[model samples]
Target: MRTSGVLPDAFTCSFLLKACVSLLDIANGKILHGVVEKLGFGSNLFLQNMILNLYGLCGEMADAMLLFDKMPQRDVVTWNTVITQMLKRGDIEGASRLFSRLEEESGLRPNQVTVVSVLAACADLCALDLGKRVHEYSNRSGFKNNVLVCNTLIDMYAKCGSLEEASRVFDEMEGKRTVFSWSAMIVGLAAHGRAQEALSLFSSMLQDGTEPNGVTFVGLLHACAHMGLVDEGRAFFTSMTRDYGITPGIEHYGCMVDLLSRAGLVKEAYEFIMEMPIKPNGIIWGALLGGCRLHKDIKLAEQAIQHLSVLDPLNDGYYIVLSNIYAEAGRWEDVTRVRKLMKARGVKKTSGWSKITLDDGIVHEFVAGDESHPQAEGIFRKWDELVVEMMLRGYVANTSLVLLDIEEEQKVKFIYRHSEKLAVSFGLLNTPAGTTIRIIKNLRVCEDCHSALKLIAAISGREIVVRDRNRFHCFKDGCCSCGDYW
Candidate 1:
C-alpha cells in the first residue's frame, strides 16, 4: 500500500498494530508506530490506545505508562490494557491497585474483562478475602454466569485454599459450564487432594453428554495419579484413545507416567514410555524421574535423567536430584561427576520459596535461609523451639535430602531450617490454635520437611496442607495424605 502511494490512516495503522500484537511481532509493531507518527496519527486517541496496547503486549510497561499518562482523554480500554499488562508481568498488587482506580477513582465501571483480571490476580496472590469480595461484586454486577468470569472465580477460589467455594460457584453456574468450566473445577480438585471427587466430576461430565477432550483426560489422569488409582487411570487412558479418539498427547502421557510411577509401578511406567507412539518429551521423563526419586530407584532415575537432561539441559533441579541420588548411595565419584556437569552447564539450583497466607489476608514469603523479614528473628527463634520439641518427640532428620557434601550435623541442621519448615513454624507462631496452616512451596518439598511436618502436626494438633511443586500433602495425626509414598 505504501509503495502504491496509498498511505495508511489511523484506522489502518491501528488495525495493523493489533495484528502485530496478536502475532507477537514487536519488531514490525515498532515500524508501524513510526508509520503512525509519520501519518500524523500519533495524536489520534484510538491510534494512541493501540500503540499503548502494543507496548503493553510487548511487556514494555515503561513506554506503555508514558504514553498512557500523556493522553489528555482516556477510556476503559486504556485502564484495562495497562492492568492486563501488569498481570502478564506477575505484578498482581499493581494490577489490583490499577483495577481499583479504574472503577472507583476513575469513575469507570469495570467490565467482565476487568473482573477476570482482578480475580486472576487474587488467585495468584492467594488473597482469599479479596477474592471473596470480588466474587460478591461479580455476582451483584450480573457477571455471575459470564463463562470467563465464572471460570476464573472457580480457579481463584481453588488456589486461594477454598475448594468448597470453587465447587459452589460451579454448581451455581448452572447452564453456563463450558469446557473451561469443567477443566478448571477438575484440575482444582486434583490439585487440592480431592482426586476421587475430581474423577466423580469427570463421570458426571461424561454422563451429561459432554465430550471428553485432552484437557479433560489430563485432569482425570492427574487425579488418578495423586490418589494412586492406577487401574482407574489406565482405564481412562484407554478410553480416551478408544472411545474419544483423542490420541495420548505428551501431557496425557505425562499424567499416565505420573500415575503409574507414583503407584510404585516403576518398571511398568518405563515400559509404557518406551511403547509410546510419539517420542516422549521432557515432561514425560520428569514424571518418571519424580517416581524414581520417591522409590529410590537409582537405575531407572539414571535412564530418566539421560533423556531429561537432553531435553531440559539447563534445568538445575534434575542435575541436583541426580547428584542427590548418587549422594544417598555414597557414590561420591558419581555425585562429583553430576556436580561437575552442573558447573559446566552453568546451572545453579535456585533456592526454594514458601508462601503462607495468614488469617488477616497478608501473604508472607520465606526463602531458604532468608532473614530479611521484619519478624525474622522471632520466626527463627520459634523455628528452633519447634525443632527441639520435634526432636524430643523422636523426629529423626531425614538428611539424605540435603545435597551438600558436608558434616552429618551440618546436614541435619540444613534440613531443619528449610524454608517450608520456617514457614510452618511462623504459621504456628502467628495463627491461633486449631487453625489450618496452608503453605505453598516453589520447589518440591524435601523428604526431611515432609517427615517433620507429619510429626509437627501430631505434636501441635494442627492440620497442615502444603502445596508443593508436585502435589498437595495434607498432614494430620502423624501421617501424610500421600501415605509416605509421595
Candidate 2:
C-alpha cells in the first residue's frame, strides 16, 4: 500500500508485523517498527501491542519490555502477550506474577490463551498444585471444553507427572477429541511406562476413525521402545510409512534406534542407522551411542563416536557417553583418551541437576554435590543415613560410573553426592510417607543412581518417579517400571 502511494494505517502495520513475527523475520521486523513510527501510529494501542508481541516472539524480551513500559494504555491483549512470551522463554515466575496481576490489578479475566500459557509454565516447573488450581478455574469458567485449553491441560497434567488426570481429561472429552488431543494423550501414556495402555488408546483412536499423524506414531514407537517390544516397534514403524504413507522423520528413526539399542540389539541398531533413507543425524547416532553405553558395546560405541564427532563435533554428551562405555568396559586407557580429547576440544560436559517439587508449591533444584539450599546440612545428614541403611541392606555402591582416576572409597562417596539422591533424600526428610517423590534430571541417570534408587524405594517404601534425560522411570517395591532395562 505504501509503494502504491497509499499511507498504511495501524491495521496494515499490525498485519505486517504479525506476518514478520510468524516468519521470525527479525531483520524486516525492525524495519516495520520504523514504518509504524513513521506512520505516526506509535500511540495506536493495537499496533503497539502487535509490535510488543513481535519483539517478544523474536526473543527480544528486553525490547518488548521497554516498549511495554512506555505505552500509556495497556489492554488485556497486551498483558496476555507479555505473559505468554515470558512463559515461552521459560520465565515461569515472571509469567505467574503477571498472570496473578491480570485478575488482581487489571480485573481482566484470563481467556483460554492466557490460561493455556500459564498451564504450560506450571508444567515446566512441575507445580502440580498451581496446575490443579488452573484446571479448577478452567472448569468453573467453562474453558476446559475449549480444544486448545483442553489439549494444553492434558499436556500440563502429563508433564507434571499426573498421567491419570491427563487420561481422565482425554477420556471425558469424547466429542471434542482432535488429532492433537489423541497425540498428546498417547505421548503422555507412553512416557509414563504405560505402553499397553497407550497402544490400547491408539487402537481406540483408530476405532473411533481418528487417523494417526506423525506424532501419533512417535508415541507408539516410544511405547515400544520402553516396553522392549522390538517386534511391535518394527511393525509400527513399517505401518507408519507403508500404511499411512507418512515419511519417517529423524525423531522416528531415533526412536527405532532406541528401541533396538535399548533392547541390546546394538548391532541391529547400527545396521538400521546405515539403512536410513535420510542421513542419520546426531539424534540417531546418539541413540545408538546411548544403547552402546547401556549394553557396553565398545565397538559400536566407537563407531557411533566416529559419526557423532563429524555430525555434532561440539556436543560433549557424545564424548562423555563414549567415556562412560569405556569405563564400564574397564578400558581405563580408552576412558583417559576420550577425556583428553574432550579437554583438548574444550568440550565442557553439561552438569547434571535435579528438581524436586515441594508440597508448598516450590520447586527446589539440586546440582551434583550442591550445598546451596538452606537445609543442606539436614539433607546431607538424611542422605548419609540412607546410605548406611542401604549398605546394611546389602547395597554396594557401583563406583564404575565414577570416571575419575581416584580411590575406590572416594568413588563411592562421589556416588552419594549425585543430584537425584540428594533430592530424594530431601524429599524423604520433609514429605510424609506414601507421598510420591518426583525428580527431573538434566542428564541421563547413571547406572549407579538407577541401582541406588531401586534400593531406596525398597528401603523407604516410597514410590519415586524420575524423569531422567532419556525416559521416565518409576521405582516402587524394589523395582523400576522399566524392569532394569532402561
Candidate 3:
C-alpha cells in the first residue's frame, strides 16, 4: 500500500498487528509499528495496545515497557499484558511490583485476571502474608466467589504451607468445584504428605461425578509415592488406561518411576523404563538413579549415569550424585574422575540455599555456612543452643554421606551449618515458641539435616515445615509426616 501510494488506515494496521502477534513475527511487527507512526496512526489507543500485545507475546519486554511508559492513556489490558509477560519471563518479583504500581498509580481496581496472576506469583514465592492481603482485597472487591480466583487461592495457600487455609478455601468452593479445583486440592494434599486424605478425596471426587484427568492421577501417584504404596501406584497407573482411557504422558510416567524408585524397586523401575512405549527422558533415568542412591546399588547407578550423560550432560546434579554414590562405596578414584569430568564440561554443582518469609512479608535467604545477615550472630548462637538440646534428645549427626575427605570434626561442623538449619534457627529466634516455621530449600534436604530438624522441632516445641526440591517434610514431636519414606 505504501509503494502504491495508497495510505493504510488504523483498521488495516490493527489487523496486520494481530496477524504479527499470531505468527510471532516481531521483525515485521517492528516495521509495521514504524509505518503506523509515519502514517500518524500511532496515537490510536487500540493500535498502541495491539503493538504492546505484539511485543509482550514475542518476549520483548524491553520494548513493551518502553512503549508502556510512553503511552499517555492506558487501560487495565495494558497493565495485565505487562504483568503477564513479566511472569512468563520468570520475573515473579517484577510482576508483583507492577501489580502494586497498578493499584497505587492507576486508580484501577484489579480484575479477575490480575488477581489470578498476582496470586500465582504469591504462590511461587510462598508469600503467605501477601497472599492473605490479596484474599482480603478479593473479598472486598467481590472476586472471592469467582471460581478461577478461588482455585488459585487454594493453590496459593497450599504452596505457602497453610494446608488448613487451603482446605477451607476448597470447602468454601463446594458446589462450585471443577476438575481443576479437585486436582489442585488433591495435588496440594499429596505434596504436604497427606496421602490418605488425597486418596479419600479422590474417591469423593468420583462420587461427585467428576472424571479424573491426567493431572488428577498424577496427584494420586504422588500420594502413593510419598506413602511408599507401590502396589497402589501400580493399580492407579494401570487404571489410567483401563478405566479412565487417559493415556499416560511423560509426567505420569515420571511419577511412576519416582514411586517405584522411592519404594526401593530400582530394578523393577529400570525394567519398567525399558518396556515403556515412549522413549524415556532424563527425568526417567534420573528417577532410577535416585532410587539407586537410596538403595546403595552402585552397579545400577553406574548404568543409569551412562544414559544420563548422553541425555542430560549438563545437569550438575547427576554428576554430583554419581560422585556421591562412588564416595559412599569408598571408590575415591571414580569420584575424582567424575569431578574432573564435571570440570571439563563446565558443570558446576548448585549450591543449596533456604529462604523463609516472615510476617513482615519479606523473604530472608541463607546459604550453607552463610554469616552475612545482620542477625548472623544471633542465628549461630541460637543454633549452638539448639545443638546442646538436640544432642541431649538423642540427635546424632549422620555424616556418612558428607563425601568430603576432611576431618570428621570438620565434616560435623559442615553439616551443622546447612542452610535449612540456619533458616530455621532464624525463624525460631524471631517467632514465638508455638508458631510454625516454614522454610523453602533449593535442593533436596540432606539426611543429617532432616534428622536434626526432627529433634529440633521436638525440643523447641514447634512445628517445622520444610519444602525441599522433591517434597515437603512436616516435623513435629520427633516425627516426620512422610514417615521417613521420602
RMSD (CA, angstroms), candidate 3: 3.2
lDDT of 1 at 141: 86
lDDT of 1: 0.83
Whichever of 1 and 2 has more lDDT, that candidate is: 2
- lDDT sort, best first: 3, 2, 1
Clashing pairs in 2: none
TM-score of 2: 0.89
Kindly report which residue pairs in candidate 3 clash with one another: none
Query: How well does candidate 1 match the true structure, expressed as C-alpha RMSD?
Result: 3.0
Off by over 4 Å in 2: 1-42, 54-70, 359-361
Q: lDDT per model, in order?
A: 0.83, 0.86, 0.89
* Local lDDT at 334 for model 2: 88
lDDT (Cα, tens digit) per residue for candidate 2, span 188-222: 88887889989999999999999999999999999
lDDT (tens digit, per residue) of candidate 1 on 1-486: 889988777778878988998998878988888887787776688888888888988888887888888887778878878887776665656665676677687778878887887788777766676678778878888987788998999998887667779999999977778878888889888876678889889888877777768888888888888888899999999998899898888898899999988888999999999999999988899888888877889999999999988899998888877887787788989998998888988888888999886655556889988878888889889877887888898888887677676999998777767899889989998999998898889898877888889989998999988878777788999988776656
Query: What's the TM-score of each model vs. the native?
Result: 0.88, 0.89, 0.89
What lDDT tens digits, residue by residue, belong to model 3 across residues 1-486? 679988899989988998999899999999999988898976788899999989988999999999999998888888878887776665656666787788799898888887887778778877777678778889999997899999999999988889899999999998999999999999999998899999999999999999999999999999998888899899999999999999999999999999998889999999999999999999999998999988889988989999999999999999988898888889999999999999999899899999997776567899999989999999999999999998888888887868888999998888888999999999999997799999989999998998999998899899999989888899999999888888
What candidate 1 gets wrong by more than 4 Å, as runs, is: 1-8, 15-39, 42-46, 124-127, 357-363, 428-437, 455-463, 476-479
Candidate of highest lDDT: 3
